[model samples]
Target chain A: MKSNEPSFYEEVRVNGISRSDFLKFCTTMAAFMGLEASGVGQIVKALESKPRLPVIWFHFQECTCCSESFIRASHPIVASIVLDKISLDYQETLMAASGVQAEEAYKTVMQKFPGEYIVMVEGSIPTENEAYCCIGGRSALQILEEAVANCKAVVAWGNCASAGCVQAARPNPTGAQPVHKVISGKPVINVQGCPPIADVMAGVVVHLLTFDRIPQLDELGRPKAFYSRRVHDTCYRRANFDAGLFVESFDDEGAKRGYCLYKMGCKGPVTYNSCGIIKWNDGISYPIQSGHPCIGCSEAGFWDNGPFYQHLPSIAGFGIETTADKIGLGLGIATAVGVAGHAIVTNVRKHKEITNTPETVAEPETKKV
Target chain B: MRSRTNPMREVHVWELPVRLYHWVNALCITGLCITGYIIGNPPALMNGTEAYFNYWFGTIRFIHFLSAFLFFFNFLFRIYWGFAGNEFAKWTNFIPLKRSQWKEIMDVIKVDILQVTHKKIDSIGHNSLASVIYFITFLIFLLQCLTGFGMYSAMSNSFLPKLFAWIVPLLGGDIHARQLHHILMWAFILFAIVHVYLVFYHDYIERRGITSSMIGGWKFIEEDVYERHETESKEKAEK
Candidate 1:
């Protein structure tokens, strides 16, 4: 089967993508991956010579947004070339086979590839109950464990696989855990976001394909090439933020004028992503550019970081919503009142002691002396 | 009664450096709290036609960074002064190592917190309880610096702030670090309220000019208490 499969270059040629378009696609990938100019040639050489690497993509407790984003990689040539380059042996959403046939393809890939293939996980694993998420009567945890046992590396597709997205939010009933937390002794690359930008996802794949190893990762397991700088750092509206011009309301004049959304509860400053740079839907307007504040979808526990409309997160675990400032201000006022009350009490008690017995106060001093 | 009539002797409790540190730290804390509040909840000022014309937020951040540096250095100076300053200003007074220091703490708590006894516990400098509380406050100060510097590390390329880059992930992430730093500002505000009140109350009850001591570096101690303390120190030194 390996010998019969066409090379990525040959497949791209058959798919009607000209050599110039294919080379342009490679160059775009190299730039996205933060590789130098020479990287374009390296990518072309790798894709032309090397056999397509086997990829086993699994879906668990997630929507198929990672699949959607991947298949829609801005350019049709990119989507087709990347699809052919990876030789995706099994993907739950995109694969044509289902039921017995789908399970057969998955099992065949595991036995066939051994440690030669990469396992790309799309969602979190529910540790609380196996019934919470199951595919073909097998638990998600079971499927993930079996997939990771023989994979070259694991690519956590989105926040779901990276940081346990919405399903793992506050009071996460499913007890969902990210892929890295569940699996160890394997290199896991976190492409973090609600649905990470398609170009970023493609860049990571191209990097793995070219280097035949994982790229440099940040502390959070995200590839430093894309997630190193924050969206705020690269934002075009940063100058407006520095100038203190902000959108007070969604429908205000500042908003229409493209003022900074910091006052509108933008989490761009804290979120690490390439949205401001790579953007979505082929470098079109991202969330901030379209006048919606970032929900910090790339960050862990983003769901629990209070309402998306507020800047400060609500302090967790009081059985009700309350921001840090609310609690802090309450405590401050209480302390001031308590101090005033104590002062009154002290003065009143002193007055009473003076009126009652002057010698009583003097007796303690005399004894101490 | 005899001690009340005894001549009051002016003892130099705080050195000049200690006094300077106190005032500077106070100013830094005040500026930090105000500027930090603005940073957390910035006002939506839509002034000027172009972004380049208004630099209010930038100016606010500059002041915050400036005060933070001043506050950090001032705190370090105080730590050094604890070792190098006069005996009353030494670290020993705040550590609560000795039995007598623990007893004084209990006595102060009883008089101040419980209000069960009218007995006033007096010391020439800061009482053991106040010194110990200040020690805990100093720890909070250090945490504030760590979180503040950690958040700044993302924005600053300087070598100093970069040292604290690990604190953000150590405390989970940038959001948590910023939350802790913001909440601590309120802690400082509450501390100020209790601190100023206690100072005035102590000044009235002890008649030691405790409020003015910070400014003048002198406290009036009863002759017998000062004499007893002097003799005890001499004996301890001899040992």
Candidate 2:
């Protein structure tokens, strides 16, 4: 508590990350924040003076993969500083604290640093009589509401906390709700994704410590710095999208070649967030990069989008036939006829039903008729 | 120019070109609505499944596109006419900066709701009051084109669709673009219904057969009304 990470920083040695690598990591983070090159100095000052903010990350009603993903931030130094050395105050998922003591650590931090603490809530709140989800005999929603009430600002860890992920889907019996819904009168920056890339989470925290406030949020209350552009806008398979080449199946050659997944229910066209750019596994690969269609995990309600493997009804304006490329030329012939046939048969049937009264069975010609 | 033809003086009620364009847009838009609705969910065939009836779509689409093309070109002419046509067709003719128009718009609303006539100027070439309605029609037509072509853009070889991709962003996404397209079609339909009713209301109540001016190209302005064409006398006003 009394300033000692510096001496620890001096003694600590990762397998290969040089001092230069750590500084380079900080500078990269500063840049992601849209900070001036000079802002790197502020990051250095905070890292030197603050002894790493004590982050008490709470996980409930989530996959816990957000924590798993954060520690694996590709860059050894980023993972080292934020996950290893960042003096995690108490994490329900990975902390040494147990029972009341574990819960007490978070309470202590809230009381000691009312205006300066960070509350990162991962997963949605269950409101159904609190029976759906209970942590330590209390509802997760009650815990979240209390924690958020005292903190400076809240960071909704992933799509679960931000947009009420799968648990909040249609007919969500748990009554799961996102953090933003319960915590009003507070700044809640939603870092949306199924389990967002580790660096993106670190980047948000770095910006918070450096800027002393949350980064700019778009209309969805998501950080504009991250969720601004769409995945399709920057996807490597974009050329294939334009050229109309697409993967028809998981085992198909087009999939092996990594063509666009538009036909495969990739929600990239409608979804706006960073995935194609800040890919997972240290920018090594993302879902799209790994030859899997993007299920749009970063968006609000991806789970209810049905099975990830099955493509949706063709996004009308976007092409529908993702896996139907076997008889590519025939698709045009087939769909065109389908369109024409649908309209004509419909109209003709309507016309005939109105006019084709059988002469014998039809009402006898009345004087009124 | 009240001495010539004051808007407040209620001279010529509707100008030829502007009025004609308004009515034509209304009629075509109504046609677009009825046909579009039928196209979206066609009637069941009385004939067996194999019986072909493909031309209905072709015919409706052709009618829609042709009418749309006429409306769009008519818009182009109006834009040019806004600069080069007669005094009423000029850009000044389309302005509505009158303090009373805004003040009376509420009165217009009240009167409309109560089925009473509010104090309003008889305008020629769109009254300061009616000009706002025309401008609204103008804006809707533009939106209809953008939305219409955006729907058509999903097809293979349409030019307007390619040129106007901005509609996708306005819709927040393509996943529900058809839903949006369908919704906007109904909007234009509602607009046309109100538009026709208003035109008829003005014609019948105001004693101005303004609906025919679009077809006939001349309003039967009352004599001594100082209709911008001061050349016409009472004797000629009747003629």
Cα lDDT tens digits for candidate 1, A191-270 = 99989899999888878878999999988999999998888999999999888888888888888888989877789988
User: Which pairs clash in model 1?
Assistant: none
- Going through the candidates in order, what is the number of backbone clashes in each? 0, 6
The DockQ figures for the candidates are 0.52, 0.04
Candidate 2 chain B — worst ten consecutive residues by lDDT sum?
Answer: B45-54
Cα TM-score of candidate 1: 0.94
Scoring only the A-chain of each prediction against the true A-chain gives TM-scores of 0.94, 0.79
Model 1 lDDT per residue over B103-159, tens place? 999988877776667775667788899999999899999999999999888888999
**lDDT (tens digit, per residue) of candidate 2 on A1-369:** 446555223423443556687678778787666678898888766655565555667887888878888888867766665445433567877776789898798888887778778888788888876767788998887787788787888889999999789898877888888888877988999998888878788889878766777889876777888876778777887766544456666787767767667667677755666787777787888878888778878877677653565544222233443322223324545554554564454344323222333331132222211
lDDT of candidate 2 vs native? 0.65
lDDT for A339 in candidate 2 is 47
Q: After superposition, how far is residue B199 of candidate 1 from its true place, in Å?
A: 1.6
**Candidate 2 backbone collisions, by pair:** A263-A322, A344-B53, A349-B45, A349-B46, B12-B124, B15-B125
